[model samples]
Target: MSTQPRTAVVIGGGITGLATAALLAREGLEVTVLEKQPETGGRAGSWETGGFRFDTGPSWYLMPEVFDHFFRLLGTSAAEQLQLVKLDPGYRVLFEGQTGPVDIAATREENIALFDSLEPGAGQRLEEYLESSEEVYAMAKKRFLYSTFASFLPLLRPDVLRRGPRLARLLLEPLSSFVAKRFTDPRIRQILGYPAVFLGSSPFTTPSMYHLMSRLDLADGVLYPMGGFHRIVSVIGDLAQAEGARVITGAEVTSIRTEVSGRKTRATGVQYRSPDGTLESLDADLVVSAADLHHTETELLPLELQTYPEKYWQRRVPGPGGLLLHLGVQGTLPQLQHHTLLFTEDWKANFEKIFGKDTSVPDPASLYVCRPSATDPDAAPEGHENLFVLVPVPSDPSLGAGGIDGAGDPRIEKMADAVIAQISSWAGIPDLAERIIIRRTVGPQDFVTDLNSWRGTLLGPAHILKQSAFFRGSNASRKVDGLLYAGGSTLPGIGLPMCLISAELILKRLRGDTGTEALPEPAPWSATADSRPESAGRAAGGDAKPLPAEPSSGDGA
Candidate 1:
């Protein structure tokens, strides 16, 4: 290796890719980020039409701590970077057969009361559940979420060893069964289990370990970064450039260039097609593929260079895809909150259909709806609403892609029409379809064509126990030197927070650091400045500002 200055090339400019570029640049490595889309953000991107701005990806802003940690690493904070609105009654739930929607208040008391109203004595059970959820979350945030898992010994520490039995039980029990054991009212059970969908699995399949997700919303409250998640993307993109990293959009990485020398194989750089229709190559000391993991392995590298080859993926289960709708409504929606979840009466059957051996879209689907205009006025024009809807379905690319107007694939448009009618009737908005002046549909095939998503899975691999935490795909390429991975497809599971942590994992792997804790707040970072992050550390005392604690918080869409 020629040593002048270390350089890194990051593939895909989605949230993880962008975050990786900024972190790598801050580490003093020259960095370049390539994004295939015209814009960055990947699944977290947004769309604008009819004077309305609809967030296309990741509508919820859960895990405030993760957001803060990522920004602090970049010498900033979420509060300093984005306009966040802490939603009151974090979100509302509309269970089938219910006369009206039940609000999930940020305060424990209100939430307890809401649970009690649904089923008597359920209030006390909720308190116990949240307390347990908090405990599990505290344990997970440290040992698992930030873990490199390079050593199983760190998890053998006394504190963790003591919880071994409990941890095993958590891993063994299904989240749906766990909730059902506590709350008899199906609505209460569904409320507790619904978070699994956001994690890209059905509750019945997801282990009880993920009950920690409930602590985010039912306890902490929900936040929406104004201007949508794309704003966060732009902020990270800007930070990368500010740190001297080059972010190139409309650049499609065709292949990761590699060479075999002596006995070892290593990634030297990548070849990509430029916007002007020319093939370009960039040489780097290291390369990080933050694109879809399966695509990177199966398509970007030769069979011999592939780490997780096609045969490896054949045994894996893909996450659920989405039937998404972005609609600009003509008038206000009184029945819906900023975040609304309409649960189907047959929650078990609904999930079965979505994640079954022969998967299909659920007819009486348990769907999520986001009306951003309720929180951010700028989301819509006057007297208008920007509604983002998601109904989980099979991750089969054959289901077909989405389109504008009523022009999507027949199967996709049919689902959209049915969902529109369902939501209109359930929410008591008879004219909902007619009031939709602008509509956009995104189906499973959209994920395939637009994102190179394996099996059109919207969130990568499902968070089943086997596919989670230590068992998840490794971030570093085992056979290729100077190659790494980040994003949902790798270790630590799904969602925006996990994506950010995946980037941190890349940083750790590069530094040969195996400690499983958030890196300390580095003293003012700069491009080409490779000073050790001031340690001893922010956990004890540092001049870094305190992380903001909001309405005790949460978002999933």
Candidate 2:
């Protein structure tokens, strides 16, 4: 390895890409970020409509310390750079057919009290659950999340081994089972399972270990930036640029070029198609892909250098794609909190229909509503609200299986109206549909077409027993020498914090500090057919066997 300032090319300027580039640059490497959109912040992008601003994607800001750690690495605090306000009642939950709503207060004690009010001894049970979750979080941070694990030894350390039984217990139990075992009240179970939905998996399939998400909220507290999540993208973008990284917006990368033959094959640079239709190639020594892993492997890399077979993707389950409604409303929503979940009575059936049966909207489906104006006045005009509503839908093409037919079809409108009606009745807001100043919707097709997500999957591969941990896409590309993967689709699974950790893991591999042997080439591509078997393919070659089930553990904070 040379000590020279290595040239790095970051594909896709999302949070993961930007964070990776900034971290690498701060380490004295030369970095450049390329984005296809007119601006940065891939899914977290912002837009303006009818004189109002909407965050567009990723409205919730959980785990503020993750952001703080990112900034702290650069000798600054995130709060010092961005104005963050801790939400009092983190968010609200409106259960279907329930009389009153549930609020998650900031402090752990307060949140426990709220649960206690629902059941006789729920407060004590919640505390016990949280303590176990904290242990999971601590172990996950040290063993699995922070560093690269090319082999299983890192996860099999003596300390982790001692905790293995507990972890296995947590993993074997489904989230629904765990929640039910803990609390007698259905409302508490609903609260515990809320974050699992965001992972694109249902509580029935998602492991109970994910309950750490609830502890995270009650312990760390929910927060919001003064402006919006976009402000976060802007600040990180600024920090990356300050570290001498060049961010080129509106530049779409068409392909990645690699040298062949010799053992030390390396990434030369990339071929990009600009907005004006001009094709250009730039040279680089290293490449980190933060875009969709499927697109990067199948499209950007030449077929002669492809990695795993298309069949590998077939066995994996992709989570449901969401149908989003972005609205700039005209009057205040009196009872609406900063965040709310309107749970459908038949939660399990709805999930089964979407994930198992590959169907569309259910008659009474779970809905997540976010009224940013409730927390930050700047998100909307005086007495107005900026509401982002999301409902889970099937990612498959067989439309009308459940209720909706397709995007922009009458079925979509009908479903949206039904959700609006529910909100209207629950909040006692009259003519809620009429107050809309601007409306924008994104469905499964949009996720596939625009974001290039495989099978229109919202997050990445499902967090199933066979797909989690090292089973997920490896951070360092096995096919190409110099190429690395960093995003929601890779190791450590989905979520803002996990994605950031993914980037960090890739960086550690690049620096050769994780004790793994280096690839013979810089960035090697795999040459395999789409129908090839999972075992013994060209690009990042390895047996495609399912990874053994380890323990239930937390992720890096």
TM-score of each: 0.93, 0.88
The alpha-carbon deviation from the true structure for residue 103 of candidate 1, after best TM-score superposition, in angstroms, is: 0.8
lDDT of 2 by residue, 373-475 (tens): 8877767778678888888777753332122113364556666778788788876677898897766666666566566778876677778656676667577
Off by over 4 Å in 1: 1-5, 523-557
Per residue, candidate 1 scores C-alpha lDDT tens digits across 403-505 of: 8898999989999999999999899999999999998899888887788899999899999988998788788888888888899999787999989999988
* lDDT of candidates 1 onward, in order: 0.84, 0.72
Instruction: Give model 2's TM-score versus the native structure.
Output: 0.88
Q: Pick the candidate with the highest TM-score.
A: 1
Error of 2 at 82 (Å): 1.4
Each model's Cα RMSD? 6.0, 10.8
Best by lDDT: 1
Q: What are the clash counts of all predictions, listed in order? A: 6, 16
Minimum summed lDDT over a 10-residue window in model 2 is located at 548-557
